[model samples]
Target: MSETGKDEKKTKKKGKGLLVKAIVGLGLVGSGGGAAFGMMQAGIIGGEHEKEDNEPKLVRKGEEDPYAPASKDKETEGLGEVHGEGGSEYRTSYYSFTEDFTSNLAHSDALIQVSLAASTRRDGRVLLWTKKHELAIRSAILGVLADTPEEDVYALAGKERLQKRLTVAINKVLTEREGFGGIDNVYFKSFIIQ
Candidate 1:
């Protein structure tokens, strides 16, 4: 073998060793950076915004609530509370039907108009259902009012009974539409017969 060939072989081996070391170093640096990013995302490192909790913790009486909306007053917090038959606490809420219904009375020349609102001690879902099914509820209410006799609107007892029937009709519509009837009552915001 010539001396030049051996010298070239040694030089090539040293160059290859340096190239391998450079590649391994770059790989180590890239993996280390990726691991640091993952650790920050998992909140084991320096990231401040990663949070596991979505809902605020329940605030007890007289204690301050940091996450409460600025417009909501603390004193009005439990106004819609209800106690169940088994003594569990629940919330009550109301939903007002925005449009009023007018219908001609059954078997008479009288015309009637009524503005209504419904309430439930269950949850906000009842209110949501009421809004979603308002058209059907309005139809059912008109039917009830049309079937009402002129005498019924004039008498207190009969008016109360009609209110109950209206409530039942509303609950029926809700049950059919949303598969739940949690409305406790239907209240007459305005009632007129002429």
Candidate 2:
């Protein structure tokens, strides 16, 4: 073949090869993008549609809670306390730990003991979870107490901060276990430092 013709043919083949490669690359990219979009729509990738099952919800004073723990005594079935209209619209429930938490103070020989109760405005599932996970909650509480400074336990402001920390600790445990933390406040039912 003539030199110019041979060179032209080779250039044409190279051009065709480049075009095919470009098309194949574009096709692969399009397929990947489509798959990712499908996964997101199906909730397999992004968590936009993901939701907790039967998450605890706030209970109004007169509203019923389907998730509330059933009363063991038939006599108490209709004996629930009536809430007044003056306070919060939501009903508050309390869960008291059965045992006291005793731990040595941080960086001191002094010891502290406390009996605590947690409150929640949500349904009774929170209380039930608290009772069920009391062991883990107690451990978290003791860790906080052991880390608390001795002087902090004596001051009112420091005590308030400690309460907040304890509340966070309890909620962290509950969230890790049950995917939700409903504790509103942590009350010091009894506090003693020795």
lDDT of 2 by residue, 121-142 (tens): 8988888888878889999999
In candidate 1, the residue pairs with backbone N, CA or C atoms under 3 Å apart (3 or more residues apart, or in different chains) clash, namely none
Write down the TM-score for model 2. Answer: 0.69
> Model 2 scores what on Cα lDDT?
0.86
lDDT of 1 by residue, 1-194 (tens): 89999999999998999999999998998899799888888888887967654322333333443433234344333223233344314333556677788999889999998888776755445655676677898889999998999989999998999989998999899888777777778788898888
Which ranges of candidate 2 are over 4 A from the true structure? 1-53, 72-85
How many clashes show up per model?
A: 0, 0
Cα error, residue 36 of model 2, in Å, equals 18
How do all models score by TM-score? 0.55, 0.69
Model 1 has an lDDT value of 0.73
